[model samples]
Target: MKLPHPIQYQGSKRNLASQILQYFPLDIETLIEPFAGSAAISVAAAYNNYANKFIINDLNKPLLNLLELIIEHPNKISNNYEKIWNKQHINSVEHYFEIREKFNKSKDSSLFLYLMARCAKGAVRYNKSGEFNQSPDKRRKGTIPERMKKNIMGVSSLLKGKVKFKSEDYRLLINDISEKDLLYMDPPYQGVCSNRDSRYYSGIDHSEFVVFLEELNNKNISYIISYDGRLGDKKYGEPMPKHLNLEHIEINAGRSSQATLLGKKDITYESLYLSKALQKRIINDNQNTLIMKELKYA
Candidate 1:
């Protein structure tokens, strides 16, 4: 089976696969990913064959169409991605923006995926004019993984019919969700990554998110949310929030995205991993040292 998250998405939850799965109930009948970006959580969920039904969502229509094609024709996608993997061109800012704008206009999923890989910083940047504006990276490394196409196909097969893809307001989802369902929401980060200037993340509001969290707090259904951590870092070693009775964790959110905003604030610090019991365990173990220090200093 092709790996489901064939197309790379910014802020993918591949990192959260293990943690999210652990927190998820074993008896889930339906798996819902409200912010299904990289299929990180969804791909892993489908691969495990855990849920009898899967509900995947993202606001980007083009990205959704890519998912549609993946569901419909895996081999065709692999062949198209092959064309992308083999092609070469001058790598520059204008060249990237130009290529991306032109390519976005095309009705081709492989082209979209290829540009996403080749563009500047892998950020899906855009202009107010609705143009792709991320410059090209002259020094970018590696071809699209030699195994990328195969992986996508693998995921597609695993998700066959067990999956339902949708593009809708996450708030609207509460209408259909049941008390027993599990919802995974990895919305764009609060300050920088939220869907204001960013093209890829789309519009998810803080108020809306807070409401969603409140609903989760009120409902009997289980949920896990991935959002920005404080300290301008992903591993927030600070004490858990008093109100939520939450947990905080410190994990290397990968070395590449270690920037402050994504992390590259140029300072050294970390953010918290907000979750339920399992995160409490991970944080209580190793991060307690720093937590105590922060307590002493604060």
Candidate 2:
């Protein structure tokens, strides 16, 4: 029997992978994922027994650092998680703070796993000093999976030199793609996290994302761009070229409270709208960079 494919993300789009896979041809030579948050796409493609022509990139340093540990020293990190997971903690804010302090002092994947597992609501937050500031999950007790160490070790074994991970600003990744390359770009949500300072996704400017999309369009690279339709401002609007195809996808984001630390039990589901806009630009005379679209999100 074939080995069962592992879903390597805390909140992965494995369910949507099948639909997204439709955008990709089976015989494609390369997969270009510029914003590989949590490596959902990379892990999914690798699990499907694809070739090693996957190039994944992200700007976040800590997240990539953890993945490096998972790739290089999975056993030690898994052992670290098992050791940390076995300990019991009292339901006190003070105990949470103590663990948080320790997590900040260490930079290994073991501490990363422990913090992610035990942190309140599993939000990875850091202070200006780059310290792990998320509190402990006091409401629920953690149940460490049996043989979790081995399972994590299995993540590295599964990857096995088939995936190439990169840490860089996605805007600079256009050079990495060519014609016929399948690029699945999952950038940070435009506005939902902007209004609240509690969100960990910082420094992602929506305007920059629009520019990035334009670059990809100019290069004639095949790609599927995912973004939020519920813009923070109702005044927001976008104009996709009449030539490129446009499509909408609606998926419930679900109750926010159940999905986050503040657990207000919000029923709002985040609907992801994917678009493929490619249009012919009419150039009369002088031309610099042909701008096809300006992203206007709510």
Candidate 3:
């Protein structure tokens, strides 16, 4: 199924959601996303009925608020978006920067959505003072109002009552996670964005993140992390420590668009790390499936 995504995020797992979800158990009480950019995984999980409830959290307050509006008050957000999008007809670039200035001051979710749609490459970049500074994509205007409405409404219908929105540090959120809940983490890439990359307002320390993973293991919580990977021979981030005992899988994310444009056939592979407990559950689920198939044949 083509999942609905109201926003275009640069590193969104929307395209890779199905492949990542293959490891999810058939039953999940809650699916928590600590770094829920666009909440792509949560949206996919809800679409596939893989989780009964969802907790979507992000440190980016404006982005999280935009998501909340998309999931709870679709009509209001869609209408506001249309108004903003329509104004750009006269001078799209000027209108985009105007919206960006307003968003930085007001932090209005609707304005944030408009800027996200019109931003160059859908890349979220912030200055030292935490301002949205990405330039507009002059090649084309943002998504049309009709398509935006459809996507916003589709996401709202799927997750309105089933989701809880949060704007908090991931560390604070993880403390409340229970064994029944499954956590899917797509944290800032260690090397690329972990050290205060302009893409984020702030960056997580690699050592601190490792310690956080250790704590999760101690609590026996199940998690799936989309941490790091490579493009051709060049790797992006440091590998997860072996001591964590997480099962690592590399997903082929297909050819890199940048590489293709450069006339290089470099395939981008993303790293997926699964907690040991989750891995064991997946193995058991597969065995049961095979057993059921054999019995039916007999």
> Which numbered prediction scores highest in TM-score against the true structure?
3
**Highest lDDT against the true fold, candidate:** 3
lDDT of 3: 0.90
RMSD of each: 8.6, 9.8, 1.3
Count of steric clashes across candidates, in order:
18, 10, 0
lDDT tens per residue, model 3, 17-83? 9999998987678999999989999999999999869999998988898999999999999999999
lDDT of 3 at 101: 94
Sorted on lDDT, best first, the list reads 3, 1, 2
Model 2: pairs clashing at backbone N, Cα or C within 3 Å? 231-298, 232-298, 244-278, 253-269, 253-270, 254-269, 255-266, 257-263, 257-264, 257-265
TM-score of 1: 0.73
- TM-score for each prediction? 0.73, 0.71, 0.97
Q: CA lDDT, every prediction?
A: 0.63, 0.57, 0.90
lDDT of 2 by residue, 1-298 (tens): 2322222333455546655554444444677777676666666676675445777676666666666666667766766666666565554456456556775676555566666766766566667665666767777544364545555555677665656778887777777777656777666565633453333434567666766666776676666655543322222224334334544454544444444666444444333333342111112111322232222321
Scored against the true structure, residue 228 in model 3 reaches a CA lDDT of 92
lDDT of 1 at 240: 29
